[model samples]
Target: MTFVIQLMSGLAVGCIYGLVAIGFSMIYRAMGLVNFAQADIMMIGAFLGYAILVAAPGIPFWLAIIGAMLGAALLGFVIERVAIRPSVARRADQVYLVLLTLGIGIVLSNGARLIWGADPVVYPTGLTHQTLTLAGYPLPAVYLYIAVVMPALLVGLHLFFTRTWLGLALRAAADDPDTAATMGVRPALATSVSFALASAIGAAAGVLYAPISYVSFDMGVIGVKAFAAAVVGTLGSIPGAVLGGFIIGLGETFGGQLIATEYQDSIAFAIMIGILLLKPTGLLSGARR
Candidate 1:
């Protein structure tokens, strides 16, 4: 029962990682460039939700998340249009693109620090202060909520990609921009939408995460784990990202519990290194560019 409880908690955290990783996958799929700012955008989303909740104490938690998603989406769109597009247009080197994103991430993290200060902010969890018991152990409702929510979101996304016109276009664009453009899809618009989607999804992860963890300007460091998940699961693969997230999350929790808590972060990095050494393309990369 204790093991089960810990697993549940780890899975809840994994859900957040998976959500953020999806954002990474989306942008990489569309633009073939990793957005270093992905995690910072998530941090921005968490702060946005916190701000909304603070301003209107009566607002629903879900509503606050929605607001954060919208705000992050807009931010993503603007950044793509103003910063990324210009770089692509100039035919800059891949290294330059990487540096550009890294700079954007630094600016965002510092800007957030300037606004919210460096302290961690507490976030509200709408769940009751009660725990549900199964066998001899108790589990928080937050864990159950997250488990359900994450899978549901993933399913919805899968359906959207398989069933919707825009989603198909996005997929087509990601698979091959030239072919997609020849099919009358607007590559620029699709790429912008993909960035917006990635930002919104990342922000949603932040919203979910803020409830369980402290929100801080420096919280963007968690992105390191999420990015590792993306690589381990295979960049540009949604399902792969999700699987990588669960693996990392579970490994961290189990390692902390059975080994040393102080080395929890190291556990994830080790797993990433192991996976890369074993399979450079990742567990689920399979033919994806």
Candidate 2:
């Protein structure tokens, strides 16, 4: 029973990593540039959700998630237009653009510190400690929430990318901007939309994760593990991102139980390194972006 509970907990954490990794993969696929600030966007979303809950103590958790998503999406659009688009227009070097994202991330983290303070904050709700009886066993309510949310998100994303016009246009633009433009698919708009969608997803991860842990500006460090998941799954493949996330999540969880809690982070990276050694391009090397 303990093992089962630990497994579920790991899966929930993995889902969060997968969600953030999807953001990294999407931005890379659409813009061919890694936005290091992607994690900071998640931090911002967590903060936004915190603010929403504080403002409306009676609001549903799901509603708070949506509010965070929309707020983060708007922020993503503004960042793309004001910072990323101009750099692309000027044909900035890839290194410079990556550095720019790092700078932006630093600014965001520090700015958050100024606004929300350096101290970590916990959710005001009791869901953090709530448990549900399932299969004659008790499990954290947040785990159930994650299990439902992750699958729903995957399905929604699949439908959006497969059945929607804007989604198709975004794919075309990412594949070939010039050809897409001739077909009336604006690359710039696609890029902006991609960032917004990615940011929204990252925000969702933040909101879901908040119930399990304290929210802090430095929480973005979890992004490092998520990045490893992206690389292990294949940098631009959505399914791969999720797969890698689960692998890291489960591995670290069991490892911590069998080995030591202090080695959990190391176990995640070690798994990444081991996988990379065996499959240089990632487990889904030839998979689509």
Best by lDDT: 2
What tens digits encode model 1's per-residue C-alpha lDDT throughout 1-289? Answer: 6689788878877878888899999899898999999999999999998899888887877788789999999999999999999999899988999899889999999999999998888865455354777566787655665766687778888888899999999989988899999999998987799889999989988888886778899888899999998999999899989998998899898988999988889998899999999999899977543
Residue-level error in angstroms, candidate 1, position 57: 1.0
Error of 1 at 119 (Å): 0.9
Candidate 2: regions farther than 4 A off: none
- At residue 207, give the lDDT of candidate 1: 80
Q: What would the TM-scores of all predictions be?
A: 0.94, 0.97
Candidate 2 per-residue lDDT, tens place, 1-289, comes to: 8898788878989999999999999998897888889999999999999999999997888888899999999999999999999998999999999999899889888989999999999878777789899897788787877888889989999999899999899889888889999999877988899899999999999999998888998889999899999899998889999998899888899999999989999999999999999999999978665
**How far off is residue 49 in model 1, in Å?**
1.1
Among the numbered candidates, top TM-score falls to 2
